[model samples]
Target: MDCDVLIVGGGVAGLSLAWRLSPSRSVVLVEAEGSLAYHTSSRSARQMQPSYGPAAIQELTRRSIAMVEGISERLPAPIMVPRAMLTLGTETEVAALVAANANLESLTHSETMERSPDLRPETFEASALDGTAMEVDVPALLEFYRRQAIGTGAMVLTGAPVTAVEVVASEPAGGTDAEGAGAEDLPTRFHVTAGRHSITAGTVVDAAGAWADVVAAQFGARPRGLQPHRRSVAIVSTEHPVDPSGPMVEPADESFYYRPDGTHLLISPCESVPAEPGDAQVVDEDIAELIHRIGEVTTVGITGVERSWTGLRTQPADGLPVVGFDADVPNLFWLAGQGGYGIQTSAALATLAAGLLTGTLPDDDGWLAGALSPQRAGLG
Candidate 1:
């Protein structure tokens, strides 16, 4: 198989980039599992909260705000649903939220309660609002990108793990040509083996999400740092008649948060523990911790834990996604390390990935340019 770009992971990172690049380039997304995005991407918090994480991460997320706010107006009508976000904290955390947060420009008790009426001020010392925060239809959004990519000639292959990748000179592999037929062109090419089948492409994208570090190493990439961590969330039966329109909440310094997922609420410890990325499962201790943290905020308790799961959020030390060609590897691109913000930041990231691969780097979105560069993480 011949392709202009080979995307390793079929998660949000890989699928979004492939979709964006497919209009003018031959992009192939390879997923190790039988289905696309079966891992962390599928197991997201399923909400879009713009404010959180490090400065660089915030910048990328800041770019994503407009996309979230105006999803219907921009691409699709229902990708992002309006569900105001609230950040509840102690007095000190409130001050921190107020001081550095332009995203949460205005704060008030009435305003805060408007988003999450169930918030109890007696328990929380202070609270603020991220009025811009909203719930994202992550699966729909992923499918939107996938449909766009396939419609534009991008090929997606599931149940295929890239076993061996030998960087040949540069030739063609699989997939339809300009005339819509599978063909290969050029001399020596980068040979990528999936199962027993071989494919080639001009450039390969390491959007393998948690497995990105391993893929990078296999492709002769020596990354400065590619860190992966595990975080868990529990979908419990709050069986209480909670408003579906309730805003997402982070209690007293974001120790934990609960987002509305239909009648049930998605509760998480908002904690990240260092771990090697792969198949992740929920731990009992972590679940206990999550329950304990939620108690500190909500008067209502987890009546029942319908289900629980865990996933990996891979990132660099400096905490921004890598969205361009590797600093060392010539044809390899870094579209990994999105952490928990992958679904929210996919649109902008796809643009960055496309621009970087085509030699047209993105313009300075003010502080955003320096934030997204891998150099900040010492990867450059």
Candidate 2:
């Protein structure tokens, strides 16, 4: 098979990009799993916080909110639901809290207690509320993008893992001679093999999430030192009647967080341990650490762990996503390393990437385009 673009991952980033480009490009998405979003994309915290993560990510997320909201309108069900954010802090964390929120206001222990009754007031000296955060319907969002891409004639293949790629460079188009090629310059092509299927495309995209660098190496591109970090979450029964409308509660320093997940509360240690890329399972020790940390700030008691799971947050050294063409590989794009902020930033990041590929990005997106370029990571 042949296409204009061959996307190597079916996660939100890859799916969203394919959807955006398929209107004018022959796009084909190949997933290593039996189904789409079987990894980090499905195992997310499922929250959309515009002010979260590094500066570059924040920019992309801020730009994505409008796009996400717009897409939500077209979906049969609501994709975004309002949910405030509350960060409990001590005096030592005042500077960090202030830096994170310019308009942060001090919440007295009494006021904080009133907002989230489960929090142990004595453990916190101050608190701030971010009213703009929301809970994202990840399943619906992913489905929307998938349906849009397929409707636009993009082919999606699951359980077909790309194992090899060969880049072929030849003479310019429509200029050839018997002895030697005329022009002697042309764009490269990628021949990819996935399972029993073989595909050729003018451009290839490495959006394999945790396996991004591994995919890069298959096409003779140097790895960008992308590291996959394991993050675990535990869903436990709530001892008290937790408010479903309650804001997501965490320490101002973000050591751990616990939020209402139906009648149960989902708590996490916010741990990021380096690991190999594969199916991730929850660690008992990590869950114990999460419980210990939550006990430090909340009065809730975890009687039982209903369920637990783990996901990989692949991050580069700078903690920003790499989203441009590889500096060394011709026609190969870099669209991985989104960390934990992939879902919230998918819309804007997709648009930005497609714009870069088509050379039609607006003047307003120049900063983000440059910041996420492969050159910023010293690959240029």
Candidate 3:
């Protein structure tokens, strides 16, 4: 099969980029899993907060949320639902948070309790509220991109892990031969073998989430030192009826967070333990510690753990995504290391990456282009 771009991942990152680029270019997406979103994208907190992550990520997330909201009417169901985020901490911590972000509304202990009655009064001295947070319908969003990409003639293959890649250098312009042309002067194509399928493409995108660096290595590209961190979540039954509309609560330090999920509460320790790329399993000790912490911070007694799961948040050393072409490997692009913000920032990142791939990025986005560049400083 011949394509303009070959994407090696089936998560939101790859799917979104396929949706964007397929309309203009011949695109093919291959996934190792039997179905799409089998990894981190399927195991998200499903919330988009503008105050989350680093400044660049926040910008991308804000743009992505706007894009999602703009297209909500066309989708089968609403993708973004209102869900505020309440950050609790000591008086000193709260003051620092207010000083850092002007958008956060500082609240006294009394005000915080009024907003979330489940919180214990003695646990936190003050809190801050970010009312712009929303619960994302991840399934609907992923499906939308998949349908759009397929509708636009993009080929999507499942259970097809890329096994080998051979670089075929195109002759330089002006009839220059390979031996006489400089490496930078030659354009490159890739012959990729993934499972039973063989594909040839002008550009190859590594969007393999936790296995991003591994994929880069296969293409003779330098690994970007991407680390996969395990983040675990547990669903526990609450002794009292939990309000469905209640705000998601977390510490200012981000030690743990919880939100209402019907009659139960979904809690996470916000742990980022270094892990290998594979199916992440829940640790009983981590869940026990999270339950103990929540019990101390809130009056909502956790009766039993209904279920639990874990996901990997792959990140670079600088904690930003790596987009754009590799400095050494010609025609190879990276769309990885999105960390915990992949789902929230998928739309904007996809749009930016598509522009970079097609060489149509606006002049005003030079800063973003530099920030997410695979060759950017601090990525080592």
lDDT of each: 0.76, 0.85, 0.92
True-vs-predicted CA distance for residue 310, candidate 3, Å: 0.5
Descending-TM-score candidate ranking: 3, 2, 1
- For TM-score, the strongest prediction is 3
Q: Report backbone clashes per prediction.
A: 7, 0, 0
TM-scores of all candidate predictions against the true structure:
0.88, 0.94, 0.96
Q: Quote the positional error of residue 205 for candidate 1 in Å.
A: 0.7
Model 2 lDDT tens row, 61-83:
77787788899898787889877
Pairwise lDDT winner, candidates 2 and 3:
3
Candidate 2 local lDDT, residue 284: 96
Q: Residue by residue across 29-139, what tens digits does model 3's lDDT show? A: 999999999999999999898888888888998999999997687876787898889999989998898788755889998999989999888888999998988888899
Q: List the residue pairs that clash in candidate 2.
A: none
> 1-380, model 1: which lDDT tens digit per residue?
88878889899988888877998898888899999999999888876666766766665566665754555566746677777777776667778777887777545666666556666656665577777777778888788789889999998999889999897754245555677643334433468997655788888888888887788888988764768788888888763566777877776546777878777888887668888878888887877877766665565566778899989988887677776666667788788888888887888778777877786765664355456665554752
Per-residue error (Å), model 1, residue 313: 0.7
